[model samples]
Target: MCSTVVTPTDRVQPDVALPFGGWSAIVRDMSEEQSTSEPTRAFREARDFLLAHREDYETAYRDFDWPRFDRFNWACDWFDALAVEQPGVAALTIVEEDGEVNSLTYAEMAERSRQVAGWLTGAGLQPGDRVLIVLGNTIPLWEVMLACIRAGAVMIPATTLLTDADLADRITRGGVRAVVTSSSEAPRYEGIADHCIRVGIGGPVDGWLDYEDSRGYDGPVPEVDTAAHDSLLLYFTSGTTSQPKLVEHTQVSYPVGHLSTMYWIGLQPGDVHLNVSSPGWAKHSWSNVFAPWNAGATVFLCNYTRFDAEKMLQVLATYGVTTFCAPPTVWRMLIQADLSAVEIQIRECISAGEPLNPEVIEQVRNAWDVTIRDGYGQTETTAQIGNPPGQPVKLGSMGRPLPGYSIALVDPTTDEVGDDGEICIELAPPPVPLMRGYRDAKELTEESMRGGFYHTGDVASRDEEGYITYVGRSDDVFKASDYRISPFELESVLIEHPAVAEAAVVPSPDPVRLAVPKAYVVLAAGREPSRELAGEILQFCRDHLAPYKRIRRIEFAELPKTISGKIRRVELRADEAAKVDGGERTEHSYDEADFKQA
Candidate 1:
């Protein structure tokens, strides 16, 4: 049976004698200072500013000031300040492919980044010029990121897994002026323009600047004026539903907006936070760069080429990772592994990127004796809704809105506030962490920002207690025989089966009905793709779901996905329409007629 918490009718009153603690204690300890009589004034100032202006858009936008600094560097001003006092504190730790370990201290990283920034300046890298950072989870990757941050240069982060075509698209679209990558991957950029300087990290490549020499620079850190509104990073959206759009972020948006993330993750000073996310994705910056560091927590990394669940568990035990965040895919894999044998010291386990299935949540809670909190957000924003530490977590609901966020469920057709519809922000000119419109797409931005609200394009339903439940993407949802169908709801149920590894549900074209639900599934290890297995899954869904939401068809194959890991339901929907036009049907499908009693 699912361990689902029913929604409450009103705000939960805090009890005085709660065992673990309330949110206040978490926030206070997270922002506490070291070796000083006063609290961390800088953090407190920033947090107080945000709290004072919470939900007040005009005052927050107009008066909530950015940190004043004519000669300010986040690495130097913030990180260096901490490093000088705590030189031995671990800043970054990574596990290598050869079973060796590498770690960098706060002071060492600060000095290294300063040297790299000086070297890049000498190499003719100027402020405002875009640099494409394509590297894996290595020490140099973090160094380069901090160096870029210190240099006041806009960074276009690309994953090492990107192909030549993908690189070409980013280079052309992002207007990159330089490139930094490992020497082993230098061959991919052989024919690119000479204007784009190549800085190889590992070793000297032909005609490329060697990053190793950057360590020899003995000059003091270069000083520059970095305004808060200045663009710090440019991210390309993962093109799951459409073409990738360049998303721009300012110095303050991520740096300040992640206050909510720090609170959501329950990060505290002296805590070690481990997040499983590849470089180039926004989530990497969310957990690895901004959130944990904002809370003064140590950012930990466990690098692996291919995922090994057992090895990951051992690392958590060995490293004493205090807080952890991973996507649902990783969490699902962990449930299938022998979790009882692994001892995890994790205080909190959180899931984002997609909604967490109730079954997966229960399995982990049973094994680890900790609740896995569910969070909601997008590539364009910070954590909007989440079960913060000490808050009640309702199963299948993406918790309440975070402290600063105000969510309204508006009926798209009626343009009125309702219990279920498009999730939107009612305040005109939405809050921080929201993208400053899609880069170079004015029409698209205006369309999304219409009706005096920022539309999420995703649908959700809210209960009387304000707990929001994710429905489905507006485009992916459809009606079959006058009944609305949510693909995510059905897909969530399908993944509960032990035979299923991943599943994507879409509407299959039908003659009598407008459409019917069809599931595309990836089988787990040791499971075969067969009609018998497909029939078993179909039967399981039919037994669990309501009659209107039953899975009528099944296909055993790899689900189509974007370059990023998101499943592409749009592609599946189009393919199903084409197949129906061609008079094709899967042999394993079952209709209501197939289950009739004579």
Candidate 2:
């Protein structure tokens, strides 16, 4: 067993011997130091309350309260405390496609992160300094995050897939003072900034500090007087409609606020949780770091160059993943495979990133004997709505308001509370999970926080039972022949067809009806696009949808998506409008008018 000795002052004592065979940290008996910090006690009580009533949604929702913290550092007070209490427990496990598995226990991670924190301070990454971290789902990614938290440095996570131009934009706009990236990606910053600090992972690079050197630092971690409201993270939103907005989160916002997310995922201590999301996105931290770790669960990651359904199933069984969360895209793909072929132990399954179709959820439930719950949230906040464990899930609804959040559906035009309108979060007390504001954009922030609520820009309709079913984005919902239409409703139906792999519905400009619903589809494996196939698809829609909502045009093509894997329907809408203005038709588009009645 390994342990950390924390004093009443929250400082580590002299190094103690550990059986795990890594760097020695100030080891202590957690039972003796359980009440060392008030913040720790408060945080634990709130967490324990949720865990005690995970399935009892009524009690959890009614009695749960956000922990009040005037001064709190989650890494020091919570994660470190967990490390001392459950030092031998695996905190993170990363399995590679090549069959290599790397595991880090709680005690090891604490010490390693401290070493990294020391190295960072020594290297001039001081408190409040912004560091751009560009790496994949590797061990250092988690290490750096913890170290940054401990060091009180603001972090801006960047995807490895970012181009040179993207890096320049982030470095310029984010005010990045330092960059830690793989050596291979170092060359991309040649002309960006020569004076900025460069720390390379993987191996040594010219003029770049080697990250491997951090392991040698056994010095005490630098003291960080981080205020509870100090900015801790800056996330660049995926630009679906316009320029990416820089979202700012404080120390308490993401770290303490993720308690709601922990409850939504139904995470339990010692549970193995697997979430499929790339490193740069907010969802990555939502599950991979804060949510699971907040519940004292192991964060499991299966890394592959490309997604393989069968291989993923095997990994799930191999690691004994108790909780699994993936995007709607992954769930749809999983249904295409022989899901029953693998015997797994996934107890709680969840779908997020986008509203999951009922068809995908039904297939997974039939095969796995566990319902795939759907959740809703954005980069601006933690889970605001979800079908948590023990709740009777509605077919298309994203469930009820999560604990700590007060949801309101308001008419966008009149700003009146209604059953069907834009989803909004009440700001009466202002939930802890909500973002501080958009960085460097004062006007936009004010606009979002207007009318005593944070406008989510997405539309939804709440049933009498309080379950909210997502409609399209406020801008995505259009009118065809003076009738309101939702693209998601039609796209969900389109994807149910066996030949369709992915479908995006957008308003196709027409002089006759003013506008009509058009579907841009991607064919499934072994299926080819043709006139006959297009007609069949249109017929399928005609049979399922009402007369006004029928798809008037069908085109088989790849849908454009942002770097974060969200579909950019704005592009398709613009393309269709331009085509009508130029009096031209897309070469591959097939109109329903061409297909005559029998």
Candidate 3:
């Protein structure tokens, strides 16, 4: 809550005490028209090194160094520098479904964000004020995000798909002081507290400030003296297992930490990068905002009401997209279409959000001759592990650790480093990409950082070659018949079956075996749910999986998913347990015993 704004003539001495329990080297008072600042220079050097060695993974990983600076605002230091240097470069491009394309240059975006910052500041937006953003993939989302960075306000991004209860929970838990959402979404906040500073986009709403009003304000905004560790973004996780914890990021964590993500995606200057992700999630900020911009790549978006795989493919080909990133679900849907029909210019393709199945990867590679590299990380950190460009990608592996991240897979119970265990990032040296900590949850944060490492709840195994293959979440991986079972491994094989569109594997209660693997599956398009189809799918798993890890039950039904598109296996597990207690079974549920009796 420290407002360390200083004027051009006010030069404070080093190690100024901040009220927020941090020490700043200096209270920076920078002019917009000034030449390249020290922070800008240092950041550019790190970014340029990655771009220079984009294809050379070993050299980049070994020789690269994170940019170290005391005072840095990515919007002010890096993005604004790019605007001054390459004013006419396309920074963002949004292609609407109706053939409308809107593109903004670096200078234009910088100026707009500056105007927004000035307007928000004039309206009494103070430093450390948390603003909840519930907008979509429009131009204003980027503007407001950058403006908040410029104005020194913390951002809490929420998805428009959130329900009223979800909104209330976020508003209360996030301690949101302001909200910027679309005019249509403004009414959704009617039941929430009315004390928040609400701004509506696209149109006017009663009692809400109009976002369009910022266009008239072109005055100078106050300079923000943001320290490296100041809170910038507060993300609400998908909560696949439990309630979503507020993941806090500092000025350096995501804005600068995404240098690793930039490297993972293999983005370069002037490259058109298309990332299929909805707003409000971490990956959206990862690929759509920071990573592409960090590499000076054009952030491209194909805005469509509904996803059309052919149209998405055509858009990539038409726009000459050089690098593309999408979730595993999108990849699965894209491969279902005729990929060979559209010849895309995408040089790099990556998948995140969840582990990409090898079947989906193979299909895309076979059709487009471009391998889809899988990467690993959570909302708590940036891309910690990934298959960078020019690396030998191992099938079904998320690949090696990126630069600036020291990964250690440790046994959960023993906390011993090993080849197969829970994925943990070393805390010694504190990688710049890691989050500040979980906000308002000291115990949870302490637990995560307990054993000299930031423990990722997900588990994985490392090969002798150092490549990492994702296992299931630590809670999701259960034991059946005295054998450990990875739900991801089982689900991956389940999806390989042609009829299964999506699947979630969880343990079902059993009196004899303690528990057995049960798969809840969603059928592919034109596929119907039937006993014969379930038998065939189970047979597919039986053939592909080991006897111990075989899926014992199959239910042809929609799998529960978080709004971020992650399968909620915890819910599925609870449902199975409840059913066992009640002596109930779902209508579409089929068991291996039925086939055995037949």
Highest-lDDT candidate: 2
The models' CA-based lDDT, in order, is 0.75, 0.86, 0.85
**Candidate 1 lDDT by residue in tens digits, 27-98:** 244332432212234544665554444444345434543343323346545665555555556677777757
Candidate 2, 1-598: lDDT as tens digits:
1222222121112233432245333563334454258888888888888888899988988988888888878888888888877776778888989988877877888877878889989888888889999999999999999999999999999788887888899999999998999988888899795768889998999999999888777666864767889999999998865788999999889998898899989988878889999998899999999999998888899999999988998888777888999987788778878899988888899988778888888888999999999999999999999999999999888999998999999998888899989999999999999999999999999999999999999999999899999997889999999999988889889988999878899998887788999999988888998889999999999999999999999888998876556778999999888887998876678998889941
Candidate 1 residue 585 Cα shift, in angstroms, is 5.0
Candidate number that wins on TM-score, 2 or 3 = 2
RMSD of 2: 4.5
Model 1 poorest ten-residue lDDT run: 1-10
Kindly give the stretch of ten consecutive residues in candidate 3 with the minimal lDDT sum: 1-10
Per-structure clash totals for the candidates: 0, 4, 0
Candidate 1, pairs of clashing residues: none
Q: Using alpha carbons, what is the TM-score of model 1?
A: 0.87
* Candidate topping TM-score: 2
